[model samples]
Target: MPGIDRVTLTMITDNYVDMLLPDLPNVTRTGLAHHFDPKTECVQGENGIALHVDVRWGRYRYQALFDTGMSHQVLLHNMKVLGLEADEIDHIVLSHGHPDHYGGLEGLLRHRQAPTPVSAHPDAFAPRYLRLASGQVAPYFNYGLTKEAIRDSGGLLVEHTEPLEIGPGLIASGPIPRVEEFEKAPTDLSAPNALLHIRDGKIEPDIVPDDQALVIQVGDDGIVILAGCSHAGIINTIRYAKQITGRDRVVGVFGGFHLGFPGTPRSKTDKTIEALRELNVEVIAPSHCTGMESIMAIGEAFPDQFMLNVTGSKVTLQAGTQPVVDLDVEARQKIGLQ
Candidate 1:
C-alpha cells in the first residue's frame, strides 16, 4: 500500500466547456490557446463524464480511462484535442451501468487494438430501468454496454465487489456502503421511486451497486477520490475510501456529486457540503450531472477548494507540493505525448 508520487487527472468529456477560464494554481483550463491550430480545434462538451488518469509511483506509471463519456465522438474528439492517446490507457473503469458513464466504451476499445482490462462491479451490465413516480417502469438503454459488446470490442472484463488495486497507488472502490441516512440515492434516478433493474427475471430496486470511485493515495498529501456519477453518495464514497485505505486525510473529491439532478432535495446539497467540510476535503471539483445551482452552492460554501472542472482541464497533484495546473505542453509531456 505504498503511496504514489504524483497523479494527473484530465477531464476528457464533461457537461461544460469554457475556454476563457484561466489557469489556477492546480487547475489548467483548456483555453483558446489550446485551439490555436489552423482548423481551430476545440474541446467539445457533452452530458457525460470521462477522465484520463495518469499515476506515477516510483518507477511505475499507470494510465486509466475512468468512464467513457456519453459518446465515442465526444470522448475520442476530446482525447485528440487534449493530446491524450487512447492506445496508451492501461485500463478502463466504469462507475456504473448508466449510459452517460459507459457510452464510449466500445468506441474506445475499438480504437485500441490491444485488449485492455475493464474493471467494474458485476452489476454494471444488468438490465436497468427508470421507475416513474406514476409507477410506470421505463427501460434504460445503457448505450449498448453489454458483456458481448465489451468482449467483442477487445475489452477484458474484470469484475469485483471488493476493493481492488488498479495500479500502484490506485484503488477501485467496490460497492460503497450506504451509512449516511441523509445521503440517499439522488432522486433523479436511483431514488426509491425511480430506478429499477431486472434480476432473476424479477424487477427490483436498483441502487446502482456498480457506482464506485477511484482512490489515489499521494505520498503524504493524502488521497484524491474520483467518481463518475456518485449514485452511492459522494460522502459515502469518500468515507469508504478512507476506511478501506486507512487514509483519513482527503486531498480532494472530484466528479459528479449527483446533487443537482431533478427531484433531489436542496437539503442534500447542504448536507453534502457540510459533510465534505467536516472531512476537510482540500479540493472539490464537481462536474457532469452536478447541477449548476449545486455547483454554485458548493463554490460558495468552499470558495478556496472549489474547482471548475470542464472538458480538457487537467488537475495535477504531486507529493509534498500543492496541486498545479498543467498547460498543454506540460500535459503532453506528462502523458509522454511529446
Candidate 2:
C-alpha cells in the first residue's frame, strides 16, 4: 500500500462545547497526564471547539480563539485550561491571517518562549474583504493583521512560499497551486494582496499566501491532514499536502474547510465533495467556518466517518486502533439545527 497519514483533533477553542462532550466516553487519550488538571484541556466527555492537530513529532495546536463572530481572543486562558504551557511549545505554524486563526497570537506570545520561526505565508497580512450579495463588499477583517505584529509573537519567523519540512514526518503545505476545478475559494486575493514582493509583477497574490495546511503520517493507512480555514480550498490544500508529504492516501481531515460561502449551492459543492471522497478520507472533523449544510453533505458522503468537531471535542488515532470517540456534546446539539 502507498503511504498514509494519521490524524487527531483536540478541540482547543471555539463555541458549542456542551453539545459535543456527551459522545466522548470512549475516546482514548494516551499522552495526557492523568492527574486531571482543570488548567489543561482534558476532554473525557463534553464538546467545544478547542481544536488542535497533533502530528508525529511537532504537532499543530490552536492557541487562539478563532471565532470572530464571537468577540474573544483569549487563547492563553484556554491554553491553560487545556494544560499546555506555551513554553512547552517548540514550534508554531499559522493557517491564515484571519482574527480567529491569529486572534490569540498575542496570548501565545505571553508564553515563556517566543514562537519564532513560526511558519506562515507572507499573505498572512493584508486587508480582507467579504463578498456579499448585490455584489456588496465589506472589510473582511474589521481588524486587519499586520506583519510587524505577528513578528513579535514568538520564536523566529521564517516566511516560505514553498513546502518545507517543519517536524519529523510533518510538512507545512505552502501556498497551494490552484490546479483543480472542484472548489474556487473566493478570496479577496489579488496582486495587491501580496505581502512579500521583491520586484514589480514578480509574484501573484490572489493565490492567498496566507492560506496553507499541515500534513502528517499517524498510522499504517492514515494520513491526517489539518487545515486552518482552507482559504486555499480543501482539495487544493489536501493535494498540496499530498505533494509535500508524498503521501497518496488521506485518512482524515480535521480543520476548517471554510465551506461557509453563503450563496454556494450544494450542487456546486458536490464537485469538491467528490474530490474529497476520491481522496479516500476516512474522517471529516470539521469546525468553525465549515457551514452546517456542508457538514450534512459530508456526513452523507462519509456516514459514520463524518465526525462533528466543536469546542471541547477530542479525536484520537493510534496504530491499529479504532476511533474511540467522534463528536462530543456540542456537535450533536448543533447537528439537527438549534
Model 2: per-residue lDDT, tens digit, 1-338?
23223334566665434422344553433223523555444433211223455544335342321221222234555555556565655456777666666665555654556454567777676555544454444454625455666566553666778876666455677788877765664433332322222124343334355677777665554567777777678888887777666666666787777676565567656876888878867667776667767776776566656777655555666544566345444443456522
What digit string (tens of lDDT, one per residue) describes model 1 on residues 182-225? 87654344344588787788777777888999999989648999
The model with the greatest TM-score is 1
**TM-score of each prediction:** 0.91, 0.74
Task: State model 2's lDDT.
Answer: 0.57
Looking at model 1, the pairs that clash are: none
User: For each candidate, what is the lDDT?
Assistant: 0.84, 0.57
Tell me the deviation in Å of residue 333 in model 2: 8.9
